[model samples]
Target chain A: MIGNPQSVAPEPSFRDFSKLCVHTITTKPWSVEEAAEHFAMSGIGGITVWRDALANRNIYQIGQLLRDHNLSIVSLCRGGFFPNLEAAGRQAAIDDNRRAIDEAAELGAPHVVLVCGAVPGQPLTESRKQIRDGIAALMPHAEASGVRLAIEPLHPMYADNRSAINTLGQANDMAEELNSPFVGVAVDVYHLWWDPDLEKEIARCGKNGHLYAFHICDWKTPTLDLLNDRGLMGEGCINVRQIRSWVEAAGFNGFNEVEIFSNRYWAEDQAEFLEKIKHGYLYHS
Target chain B: MIGNPQSVAPEPSFRDFSKLCVHTITTKPWSVEEAAEHFAMSGIGGITVWRDALANRNIYQIGQLLRDHNLSIVSLCRGGFFPNLEAAGRQAAIDDNRRAIDEAAELGAPHVVLVCGAVPGQPLTESRKQIRDGIAALMPHAEASGVRLAIEPLHPMYADNRSAINTLGQANDMAEELNSPFVGVAVDVYHLWWDPDLEKEIARCGKNGHLYAFHICDWKTPTLDLLNDRGLMGEGCINVRQIRSWVEAAGFNGFNEVEIFSNRYWAEDQAEFLEKIKHGYLYHS
Candidate 1:
């Protein structure tokens, strides 16, 4: 297929926010209550709450508050980091994940996204095994709480400490190995837009019923920070609409979750940033 | 083999610099003549000349100078950036690569390591195609000059503007598809340590006679820059010794090329840095 002409379809026009979802971390300045109120007022359809946003709050009441605004609760922000050098640390990670799952269930979210962890000096092969084992340990609690776990394979830049699962193929492989409806993969564009096998892997996951969630963001050319330098949908090099088309073609018809982590955007007036997001969504996503 | 135990063999002790090769850019501060003097004084075996390091000098004489110093001209630093929005731009890149081949031939280097390029905002698939075509177009020239081309897949973080080939597996696929004896893949630990299929792909390339070069460096836990900020061998999390075992097991009996681009190291005294490189090679690599 060298030099063969391959082109994704043109961007689809989004006429409404009926399927739009905003991650609370995308606007880090906002509290969960504030985000819910603003997102609801802005006609956004969904909200994916970061676990930190639920700090010291009544989880059920927060779920009710979001529902009262007619917002569908998407997946919780994060729930994995299972790899550790010590057995006690790994067990602690599992326990924390269980708590995250319980919180997700209480918040009436359907799933919890996992940033499967990696230890700095540990071999990635070993870290991956631990991630799988940790997920297996949490499967019973997850099933009981009716909360799915979406494995979010991070970018390779994060392989040192953030995640051992750095490609969608790896995530799909793990999800299939786990073999549970409650265990699936979350397709995050920031982590996966660079992958050559992304389209094929997306199709595979969709066919196997493991495509559970989709996260949207752009990859800034000069990505300044490994953690917080993500661009808005249309502001960077990622062809977000094209990836979304691939996801939709692969049978994913869920919220187009906007999950950006940008210090620049956070420093801005969040209401204005949210407006830009809405515009970016309507035009770029 | 989802959760299989993969124990790489123990690190082999290096007693000499017989197979040690350092890229000129790794020292950055040293001129080619200065580098030759320092390397020869340190009893280093080989040197990979970055194109910029050869500016304003007679290429053939530079080769002879290095030969007089008893240094093997390992390979030319780089020669690929094939992807461009304009056909004219791609042609310019191909022409530039041809010039690189000529330079390598004149410099008595056996090969040119290609950091195959990607255009920002262009689809990576397109960039990859351009890279393949660019290499194909240069095959006759490369053959005529008796020089090889080594496809060096960069890290995914550089996939935006550096190279679309982000994994050794992808580079292997490209090299196999090109099917030219003059074209092979370079295994760089800095670029590929995160890949799950790395060992298998290395083995495949070795069996197919496509493993041409092996570049060594460590990935820092907090990689500060996308272009620079690489760690010395044992200073970071990369299991350089383990990867070296895999490369050796795959039948690679070539130079353990130390190719680090670090602003931190570059700022240090060049002579002091050379000493550290020697230690890093003998111990960490």
Candidate 2:
């Protein structure tokens, strides 16, 4: 059953960072070591590591470093770009995803979030099939490594190239079809806040036990860029707290991941930005 | 019944300008008079006049001028902003919409396109209800004037402020619920090309006799600006001809309205830009 009705879903009131997680890319100015140190000092509960942060570093030592700070390794940033015009290209993507899964395992992250890809000008139907198949191919490796896959349905504005999966319903459908315990969904409010069926889809995902992660970010009214212009919670129109209530009602008791890509925020002192994020989380989210 | 399965929908071959209609805003550099003369001289079949172009002009005379060039007046550019937080503001929106319908009547256009509005941070359900009520309020006036209302579903990105109705399915639902011949939905590729259910929804509107208008434009990758960054037909990833095929198969033979809003394109020589549109239409569309 879909837990509490949206109308009666209890409003969440968080006074601490007990469930707060920040993505490495959100504070793009900081290195992973610096982010881990600052986040731990700030009492942030978890960290979702972007793969870019692992470049030329010892993944295992970095994982240990995060553990030393008592930071939970929530997820690896991303791992999917499965669709391509050529078979070899798709295989390359799958290989890259496999490396991502391995990296997640090494980093002690439980899941690898997938930003399911789309080929511009290609039929979405075809890209979607490729995504499903690509995930299917990675199932064995994922299961073996104990790193789950969370399909993050991107906003439709990104449908041309970033992702073919643009709704939680689509992500739920894919997850249900894949039917793997290792496969689930990452509910990001930024991409899905506009959907009328959002509450229903959240319930469906929760009922089916496919809701694996929760990501939060706000959508600015005049979103200046197609990418990297995301607003922090309370700075834009999204009802993040209301959405959190929906997620909680759906039985998702996981990290409330703050994953933002903002040129404006990145230009600021990241330590100061992190403090603002905490303020927004406590008051708005 | 849906007219055609997407797989079997025939490829449209538009080798002439008979079904081509250009929106006044598409060539932003040109004055209404200049756009009318050039579009007519270029053998464009129709024109959709934006309200800005009618600022101080005699509406009836402009209608006559368009007709004198043998150009069919397709529809008035826009007319819906029904959702407002304040009741008086909502009433003002309805009043303004009534004026838009009257303008359409005087301009000799068959319908007024509705960009059914949204208020940032307002629950979409409330905004949607207001939109329905506002449209219903205009029904008597629209019917009496012999001018129809075409509900234009904006892209989901615009749902924050531009429109609460952001899908063909939503527009179709409103039109069916309104159940008036004077009320229908406009299918714009720029707003809806990313929808997986687009073909089915197009057919649904067609079957329900609610398909009132068809607008064409492309979505560029790395779309720098949220608004005013649209592409010409072949310049972006949209399968314009395929969607047109679906529209045609749905029993619609209306003008294919070219509605592009681009700061990049506005800086160009508009007459030359007009040539590109025709070429894009003949080949890409």
Model 2 lDDT tens row, B149-224: 9999999999999999999999999999999989999999999998999999999999988999999989888788
TM-score of candidate 1 against the unseen true structure: 0.95
Best by DockQ: 2
Per-residue lDDT of candidate 2, residues A151-224 (tens digit):
99999999999999999999999999999999999999999999999999999999998999999989988888
Candidate 2 Cα RMSD (Å): 4.4
| Model 2 regions more than 4 Å off | A1-14, B1-14
Instruction: State the lDDT at A165 in candidate 2.
Output: 98
Q: Write down the TM-score of every candidate.
A: 0.95, 0.95
Q: How big is the positional error of residue B207 in model 1, measured in Å on the Cα after superposition?
A: 1.2
Predicted structure 2: lDDT: 0.92
Instruction: DockQ for every model, please.
Output: 0.71, 0.74
Cα lDDT tens digits for candidate 1, B158-228: 99999999998889899989999999999999989999998899999999999889999898878888778
Candidate 1, residues A1-285, lDDT tens digits: the string is 233212322245535887999999998899999999999989999999999999999999999999999999998989899999999999999999999999998999999999999999899999999999999999999999999999999999999999999999999999999999899999999889999899999999999989999999898888888888999887888988889999999999999999989989999999999988987887677
